[model samples]
Target: MDTQKIPSPTLTLPKSLTGIQGLDEITGGGIPKGRPTLVCGSAGCGKTLFAMEFLVHGAMLYDEPGVFFAFEETEKDLAINVVSLGYDLDKLVAEKKIVLDHIHIERKEIEETGEYDLEGLFIRLNYAIDSIGAKRVVLDTIETLFSGLPNPLILRSELRRLFRWLKEKGVTAIVTGERGEGTLTRQGLEEYVSDCVIVLDHRVTEQSSTRRLRIVKYRGSTHGTNEYPFIIEENGFSVLPITSIGLDHTVLSERISSGIPRLDTMLDNKGYYRGSIVLVSGTAGVGKSSLAACFSDAACARGEQVLYFALEESPQQIMRNMRSIGIDLDQWEKRGLLMFHAKRPTFYGLESYLTAMHKAVNDFKPRVVVIDPLSSFIIGTNQFEAKSMIMRMVDFLKINPITVFMTHLTTGVNDFTGIDISSLIDTWLLLRDIEIGGERNRGMYILKSRGMAHSNQIREFRLTEHGVELLDVYVGPEGVLTGSSRITKEAQEKAGQLLRSQEIENKQLALERKRKAINAQIDFLKAEFDAEEVETLNDIELNKLRENLLLQDRIDMARNRKGDIITNKNSINKARGNIAKS
Candidate 1:
């Protein structure tokens, strides 16, 4: 049978790269080229910052000079504001790569008239664009430009003309606006006249704030519609588009160590597959962090970079604690192979956390990532939201093919992560406290490991001064034993075996003595028989001598012993016959 493969569409619309992290990917390349894109949001929602970044990126990175026509802030104020975000607008202007123009409209000096038009503003913008040969333009807060005009008909006409003039100038532009109550923009016309519309949102839930971005409309292009989380920091605007990731990331057959050799033995004797998501879950104080540290130490020893996110403990605290278990994380930190980012879960919202992590991972470019006690993310959010955030993180890390070792704190003996992210996990290890004989001991078991033959037996987990150790738990008729119970059971079996051996030795010794006594009795009987045979032979000899002497005397008396000797046999027979007849 022949297989058929469908080819993907090759046609795509012309777009100018935004140069902002993760934003271009969501927009399917970027905003429409040689056209205006409307970015609207409420106060302090990073609308102006987004526009400034677009212009600055075009000037500095893409070699496309830009013009910033600001109506809200002056040129000096714009330069000062963006300087903190690492954008040297003054330098770009000095280099003739950017032109900043401040257009101030005094509403008190304006009167509504039919002769009103944006022709004057266009001439000034046209001069600025031509002076620098700019390919990008940013009109921050376009509402102020027409705020003086109270006539709605003229405002709409001027908005369309302004967008059309930007396209005619062949420049990609961003128009910032204040979010309206019922519409996307305050004037409710910018969204319709622009080629693409992006909405920025700043939301606060439970006293925690997060910034999100959404592409409301993209004309003549395909774009991501999901509400993506974004963050503004010293480095600039970063958006984490969760929907931009897919399950098509490649899987690796290569395996990496879990840091604990015995634990690796339980995991098909090779360890976790590289790029796989490994979840280590246990109740409180079950060495979850310790296990994570071991993995970090092992990765750093192999000269691979590791990013550790500690939500509960501080970096110093984690390092000090790990030192108690013979895992020196400080050494790896000094070697620059390990980094610890410690923060509280409440320090940021779920989306903010995801965005920050996304940025850190991208910047560090580490091969291994460790998130200690992932359950802390569940403290302020629901299970669904937490799982969603974690799923996005997992997808992002997998795309980088980084080995992930995440620790989770469970409330009970069960391995449920509370976020229900087991399906996304490639390997799940459960650590539990086994209580027997009035003592508690740690036990580890591989709950599930996809695509590997893992051991199902529970191993007694020990945290020695050296490292983590996994020993075989005693499984017998009495039940699974561990700790002192296992040792005691082993001692009992040894004693029983020794007793059986001693019994066999004693029986063999008694049988040997009994055989020796029987031999001694047979020797005594043979000696007695020998003495009796000697005496019987002596008596027969003496009787023979007496008979011979008596015959000699009879021969001397009778005329010669020779005649008696010749006839001795016949005479003896005749005498015996005569005696019988008498």
Candidate 2:
């Protein structure tokens, strides 16, 4: 007998911060505890948002109160700005859970009378921490001190001292700075907050604006060093960290219909998969919204909650307009099945809209979400932000397993404007208005449906009072029709052909019936002639028989004239030959 010993497995753990929604999963957790993290970026790169979200989530979710020292905007302005984002900055202030100090470092407010240090900043910061008993602190745009103070050397030294002091105070701090060429911050603030450095960038590419965040350095813990897309929303900000986690790969098994039976049929069986993103892009006046509302209504009819985010129209206007097309969204709202949130995209920043959406999704817990038109969001943001927002929104929906339907505005009647969101969607439905023979007709087609077989045919659709109804596909000698003119021409040709065929069929049947009657009459006449043959020897009798036979032949001739006479002519010739032989 022998005994064996098994070796123990070794474990490696990552220490980090996870307070910001999906960020912790990316950073392995929150930033390394008690380290001064540097967040540097150009203006509007979301540096403040990144820092604020960390602190807000820390206080609200993890029970860690925080302090925010603003170097630019006042405390009141910051509170008001973040209020619409679903962040209760005022309440957090009232509860002493957060301390917001608007440090106005105006050049005129301070005098360069004598040699001094940033002892005033130290006192203010200490008072704030003592008042709130905070664990997290954020100095938004700490580089402002460099611009306000007179001595660069003293400012540099004081910055280094501030970092040391924060570490000694045992507060996990984030110091924001403006980005400079070839350096982390404009004044090289990264030299002091060197424990961890993050850079946020907002750039315009091909007219599209995008915001990206990257962790340039994380001192002790392992962290993702890639630039991630983040958004500022009504609830504050959300960073979409790219990771290998399965949280964004959830598969939804449920299916929802698109309201129109034909459209649903085009999608295979019924409709798209739950959690799938459906993009409906088309030129102007193609019934895109009508189609979207129809789908939303269908989901609501099935007892599923539906949230409609209408960016192009007001909620009341949308309800009124949809009524003309037979979509009673107000009724659905009354039944507690549908909710409509409509606002102008230019009314707020992209982050605010996203936060509103987040709130709507959270509060409504809808199974189906619809954005009447996503193109409007592009107005405030550049192409990059548009893409990032769309991607983040899609990811958010995927994780929740909610079906999302979005509409996009395109140019030209027949031409697609070509927005580059197709790659991120699960199904793309293109609606086009085709001009045919001075008339406009709408056509719909499923451009792509991932993981499912869909109809490749472009189907004809019409907006009616009952909603969008898909008609049979346009068929003609030249194949399927597109645009307005082609559809009209094909429809006309089809109607003409159908009419001609029907008329010919009717005439042929009438002639056939008449021909049979005439044949029967001739046979009876022949039988009479045969029966009376012996009695017809006299002139009078012969004359009567001849006249009667002539009359019978005339009736047969009349019947042949009504239709194709070839068959009747051959029969008549054979009969005459028989009579002559007899």
Candidate 3:
């Protein structure tokens, strides 16, 4: 029998999920397994919070215990500070799922105790890991030991050795450091932790503050390279991964009403698509808020939720204003279908504004979201940031498959602004104050609605007690007519037209009566002349007949007298013979 030697099975490292939603996504699965990661950031940049979330989410979500060794903050201070973030460290510690230890190295203690390597720190970390069976470890602000201990030569050597030991022990760990002027970490710890490095920055530009994070390098894995904006709020650290998604989201075929029937008709009698982004840009006093409220009214009417992000008005103010126009947002709020998140754009940078909106949208999960007058952000110090944030929000809402109606206030007299993102909008409603001769009227038109044949005619809209009312298109003395003036002007013109028509009718009737009278007189004269001529001709013919009869009688009498004389003379001689012959 021949004995064969089997090759030793190969073991590759497995990644340790950070449990940070955005961090895991950007890191492509989290940090490399059983390897140390470097997290360097400037002061007050939320490094400790990021690390703590990593541990807490791991322990809670994945059931992987973690150890948090604080080199800068004490265990008590860490526990107190994170309480506001809703993380109960003591509870986790009591359950034997987490371990919190504070390391304090005083400069005076270093002189009294003489030089020593960080060998004790290795032993302590291993003990804590074994006690809780933690799969993760965090050494927060580990660079502080170098400053406090003041034995740079020996401490640097041991710090390098400690990283190697942690790796060989097969426990995933995170080391945090303050960012140096030139190097990534203050003590260049990034050079030692060769697995992954993340950079956090808290920058203030033009009096607006923002927190950003970027992955400088990932030795064996791919990661998102762009700087991501994050927020540190009650829910702990949340990184907004500005990831670009392809047009792969599902497009709903359902239609939604904009609450104005006229506007709906303008949109092919179907309103807007179920997740389309509708932009309403207009001048001041142009009923932008009224339109947005109309949409909210429509949503609430359908028993769907609506989240209204009001940047210019408080909830009470918006409710009062909309109530005056017949939209009862208050009633919807009582019904628990409407939510309002009001904030001043000036109070924070554009990023903070986006964070608030993101959180509100997530919590409410409404079918509709309204950002009333996104122009408020544009008026602040950061114009570019405002536009970028708005675009990102539009993308997010579209992905949520919720209908969006964002109002933008134009500057000067224009009904549009340079900040108008036309391409990103599925429907753009351009509203304006049709000002002429001291009167201002509201008019709206669809600049563009993709995939829909919308009305091009500018329909005049009026803010009434019955909500938004869209009037028919009428080009009167004003460009578009509305209110009593339109009615009065139309009535006066109709009356003038009626008067002119009646005058023409009267003149035609009078001419017809006169023509009939003249024709009757001509007929009577012609009848009289014909009767007289017939009587005269009849009398002359009768007289001529009587004369001809008398002439015939005279001729007969002369012939008879001549014949009788001859017959009498002849009769004497031939009386005997004529008597026999007769």
**Top candidate, metric TM-score:** 1
Writing each residue's lDDT as its tens digit, candidate 3 over 1-582 gives: 545755332333467887664677787678887888988899999989988988998899888899999998898999998898788999999999899999988877656356667668988998999999988899998888877876678878998898998898887888999999899987989889988999999998778887888999898777899888776764777666755432567798899999988889989999999999998888778888889999998999999999998888999998999989988889999999999888887776677677678778888999999999888887546665665677778887898888999988887666455674777899999888766446777778898898888999877788888888888656765556655566666788799999999999999999999999999999999999999999999987777666555544554665676656554554344433533443
Q: Which is the better candidate, 1 or 3, if ranked by TM-score?
A: 1
> Candidate 2 deviates by what RMSD?
17.2
State which candidate has the highest lDDT.
1
What are the RMSDs of all candidates, in order?
A: 10.8, 17.2, 13.6
Off by over 4 Å in 3: 1-15, 110-116, 244-252, 314-339, 348-366, 391-402, 412-424, 433-442, 450-457, 464-466, 471-582
Per-model TM values vs. the true structure: 0.74, 0.63, 0.72
Clashes of 3: 0
Off by over 4 Å in 1: 1-11, 109-114, 150-152, 245-256, 272-277, 297-308, 314-341, 348-369, 382-403, 423-426, 435-439, 448-453, 476-480, 484-582
TM-score of 3: 0.72
lDDT of each: 0.86, 0.79, 0.83
Residue-level lDDT of model 2, residues 285-395, one tens digit each, is 888888888988888889999999989888888788889998888888999999988887566666557767887899999988999898887773266666766677777
Model 1, 1-582: lDDT tens digits are 435654344546678999987899999888888988999999999999999999999999999999999988999999999988888888999999999999888888876655666788889999999999999999988788656667767767877888888888899999988998888877885645558999999987667676789999998887899888777865788786755566789999998999999888888999999999999999988888889999999999999999999988999999999999999999999988999878776787776687678778988999999999799898555565677678878988998899899999998997778888888899999999999999899998999999999999999999989988899999989998999999999899899999999999999999999999999999999999999999999998787666666655665655453565565767655544644543
Task: In model 3, state the lDDT of residue 384.
Answer: 59
